[model samples]
Target: MIVRVFGFSVIVSLSALAVAFLYRGWTGLALCAILGILEVSLSFDNAVINATVLERMSRFWQQMFLTVGIVIAVFGMRLLFPLAIVWITGGLAPVEAFRLAMNPPPDGADHFADGRPSYEAILLAAHPQIAAFGGMFLLLLFLNFVLGNRGLTWLSWIERPLGQLGRLDQLAVVIALVILVVAAEYLTPDSTRATVLISGILGAVTYLLVDGLSSLFQRRQPGGPDTSSVPGPPDGDCADRTDMQHGEIRSGEPARARHRPAPIAAAVGKAGFFLFLYLEVLDASFSFDGVIGAFAITPDPILIALGLGFIGAIFVRSITIYLVRQGTLGQYRYLEHGAHWAIGALAVILLVSIRVEINEVVTGLIGVAFIGASLASSVRANRRDGRHAHHEAVRTH
Candidate 1:
């Protein structure tokens, strides 16, 4: 089971490492290994967040997400994005940017002897806008997750109050945009302030656009929601005390599943497309930090892509699939909450990092901490639930 899901990732990682050895000997191989480890450690929470989405998708779409999505993450984001950033910011041609990235200046020197800023230096300079955009997008996501009407709550003291406040429509967007504006105005330097604001605004807008389209397509799907239940027997489903009948769709669950007509069933594919699109955009927002921070490990664009993209992205995607396949989220109720908390922490870190210098490893560790605590809590909850069930059986018997 392990090998079946992760076989492709393992193959890709091994092949990439082998190529690295051939390209630059043992030193290159070691660097790639370190970067891969770093990427995985930093992104374990991303896998959790991703699982929350991948579980809702069909098996076919899940396969596409793992295969084609990795191409975008590896080649498009890790490899080409470094070049694209340099090209766009430094007014260099694509070839020049690629060359510059390939032949990076020495560490500790911000500029080449010829006075051009080094590749890492250029990335650092552009960090404000990059952080702003990603920060706002992720902030919105975190807010949406935490503020939604959820069946379970990992942190009841906090989540319950926030969920109540969620009665105010669009509160998540309002909070995210306000923070974006405030951070852009106060955290950023005067020179980059407007740029940061614009980038952050664009990020918020992008999230709204993607999320809105996804919801629209979801609603239009035949098996999707049509109208809310009017009323029902007192002992119906836990949700709304009503049955999911009369064209009602509960959550992401579709009702077709080979029962509906061919044309109506086709809406499943269209709905999956929108979900896929949302996942991709959310993924890009998550990868921004890894891609940018990867320069600190090595400025060589090829190695960065090989380590972070080839090995890390593949393994992360595989982990997402594994969680979905194993029904980890359902079994361990608090995990999704913990992952969202990690995301919220990450969002805050990114937004603050526009001015502050927070180590990427520390940022990653915070996420690990939240997830670890959540895992422990889930275990305790499961044991307690088991005890209650056992006691009830004993008494009844």
Candidate 2:
């Protein structure tokens, strides 16, 4: 399995290099490799969350996800999305945008007709749209987390009537529309107001559409075990027997055989896909910040791709695997929570970058700090639990 995974990764990397070679030879290959790495690094948490979801999926689905999903992520989101945004915003045709991006103006020419592409300069150019995108994204994330923690019942008063109307999804649409209007009226200036509004609406609509699709897909899959009914171990020796019996029951089945998912499993699967989409969008949001920030380093698209792509992808995949197999989540439940909160913070940073500037390195450090703190807390909890268990065992004996 490891060979297959790495083999596929090598094939993809080589294929990207081959295409890059066709265009710009060593330079292109170098660019692709770098951008691949950048993308991987920026999206490390995304891969971890993806693995969490993948663990619950059928082997077939897992294979499909790794193969097809990576393509979409690499090409569709990373490369094409930026080009599309640039085209739409710069008022250049698609081909023209590609050309401009691929062949950026030479350094010392004042590409924006002002000065060097400083962080302030890029932030000034991208702040409005970034702010809009980040603001709405963070707002939704905050609401989702808060409401989710409330058991989603707090929403019952609002959702019940909407549910009866069979248009709860429309509520999100409405909020997005309101945001669109507000952006048009106040957030965006006359020069770029239309573009900002369009992009904001696009982001919101995309979010709702992706969320709905993920939910639907989840409804179609088999469910998993009922977590609520997962009884605690029986007292004394019977506990061991019960655990053994459970192990025996599970061992009786073939690993690859299809089984109807229990409700909890189904919910988890669905939640996983939702998270997958969230991570994808979140990665894109982070990339937007990085891409814009990269211009400060160098606007040469080839260099950006080279520097960010290859190195980024490898680390991200490693992190994902570490999160997935190490049972970090199961062992340190709060770690996932912290990561998600970091995502929320990053989302806000992306939004705030539209109006104010924050260094990408700083952004990364903030997330790292949160993750590190969560990890430390989890480790402490584990040690404490271990000591408590020892004490209990001694007392019982």
Candidate 3:
């Protein structure tokens, strides 16, 4: 399965390269390599989070994610999204915009050297705000997922009123509205206020729409059997318990020990669709910063598309595999906590980017630090548990 997936990805990637080459030779290939790496580096945490969601899905859904999801992400979000922003804000014709993107100005020349603004400059201008909104919204989503339990305690007041809505989808809309107001009042000047407001509103609304659709589908589906197909303790248990003479079998046993009959495959299918949708949203959130950031490196639309799209697709696939083979999420619970927190921080960074440029390197470093720390903590926990297991065995013998 893994080989087939990779083979398919390579084919798709090569095909894209062929098209790019047909349009513009070495320049396109160079763009592909650069953006592919950028997307991978920036979205490392995204892959981890995606893996967490994907693990719950069936094999068929996973395949769908690799194929269809890649197309939408590469074309719709990575390519069309930036183009749409240029069209709406700069008043550029779509074909002309594509032309400008395919043909950037000479090195060191201002993108707007010609009477009109360059496609690259328009693309760059779009990032700061994208970062601001996307970063913040993702942070909020991550917080709700990770610290949602805390609402039962410290944040009861906020959670209580909001909880009345009984659906996170509704809350998403409210948050999007608030962002729109902020963009209008404070983010942009009077002349471009409408553009800023519309963009902000669109960002928030897009997030809510995609995420809400995913959740609705998820709710309609039946959960599959709680398969013990995965090895180890039902999360949160120490490994030592498995070795004891207690009724429970050891951790190494086939997970089938814990398996019950699964729900109907049709139910799994529905659940799978929702899961796929959720992964797509997560990918969008993760990619937004990187996509926007790409403008900083170069304004050429083709370059941005080639770079971001190629890397984004590869990262998505790699993340899926990592999640499946390594079980990173199950193995390192704190990873999720760290990722959520990083996403929250990124949100703040995104919002700030509207007014002030936040470096991509800084953003990447911050996210890596959080996730790395969480991973270290998980390793420590695992080691501690292992020692405890050894001690118990000695005492028992």
Which residue pairs clash in candidate 3?
Answer: 35-307, 36-311, 120-299, 131-350, 132-350, 132-351, 135-347, 136-347, 139-344, 228-255
- Candidate 2 structure quality by residue, lDDT tens digits, 295-345: 555555554554454335434554555555565555653455456556667
Best by TM-score: 1
Ordering by TM-score: 1, 3, 2
Lowest summed-lDDT stretch of 10 residues in model 1? 228-237
Overlapping backbone residue pairs in candidate 1 total 0
Pairs clashing in candidate 1? none
Ranking by lDDT: 1, 3, 2
Q: On residues 232-342, what C-alpha lDDT tens digit does candidate 3 reach at each position? A: 112222222233223455454433221211122221565577667767766776777777777766666666666677655665676667566665665664666567656
lDDT for each residue of candidate 1 in 1-397, tens digit (9 for 90 to 100): 7999989889999998998898889989998998999998889889988887676567788878987888888998888877788899988999988888778777557898999898788878999999999999889888887777544567989988897887688999999988988897789999999999999999999888877766666667766544311110111222332233434434433221111111112224766787787788878888888887877777778889999999998899989989977878666767877898998999999999999988889999999999999989978887776776677668779
Deviation from native of the Cα of residue 370 in model 2, angstroms: 0.9
User: Model 2 segments beyond 4 Å from truth?
Assistant: 1-42, 112-127, 150-190, 193-198, 224-279
**Candidate 1 lDDT:** 0.78
Which lDDT value does model 3 have at 20?
65
lDDT of 2 at 205: 63
Q: Highest lDDT, which number? A: 1
TM-score of each: 0.90, 0.67, 0.75
